[model samples]
Target: MVDLQEQAWAALLYVVLMLVQQWIHWIPGDLG
Candidate 1:
């Protein structure tokens, strides 16, 4: 059970990280 929870958390973290990258890429200016 603990292992499954860890995997789920890791997946969620990865998704959130990707979304943040996309969000920055979409924004205009020097941050991309």
Candidate 2:
């Protein structure tokens, strides 16, 4: 059970990181 919970958290963090990276890529042209 604990292992599964840890895996879920890891997956969620990975997805969040991916989204943040994409946002950073998209934000530079108009604002800067």
Candidate 3:
């Protein structure tokens, strides 16, 4: 059960990081 919980958290973090990266990339495009 603990392992499963850790996996879930890791997945969530990965998704959040992906979104943040995309947002960061978009900012430069918007500025230009």
RMSD of each: 1.8, 1.7, 2.6
Best by lDDT: 2
Ranking by lDDT: 2, 1, 3
Q: What is the C-alpha lDDT of each candidate?
A: 0.93, 0.93, 0.91
Task: Please rank every candidate by TM-score, starting with the best.
Answer: 1, 2, 3
Error of 1 at 19 (Å): 0.5
Clashes of 1: 0
* Residue 18 CA displacement from its true place in model 1, Å: 0.4
* Residue pairs in collision within model 3: none
What is the C-alpha lDDT profile of model 2 across 1-32, one tens digit per residue?
59999999999999999999899898978775
Estimate the TM-score of every prediction: 0.82, 0.80, 0.76
Q: Which residue pairs of candidate 1 clash?
A: none
Name the candidate, 1 or 3, with the larger TM-score value: 1
> Looking at model 1, which ten-residue stretch has the lowest summed lDDT?
23-32
What is the per-residue lDDT of model 3 for residues 1-32, given as tens digits with 9 covering 90 to 100?
Answer: 59999999999999999999898888876575
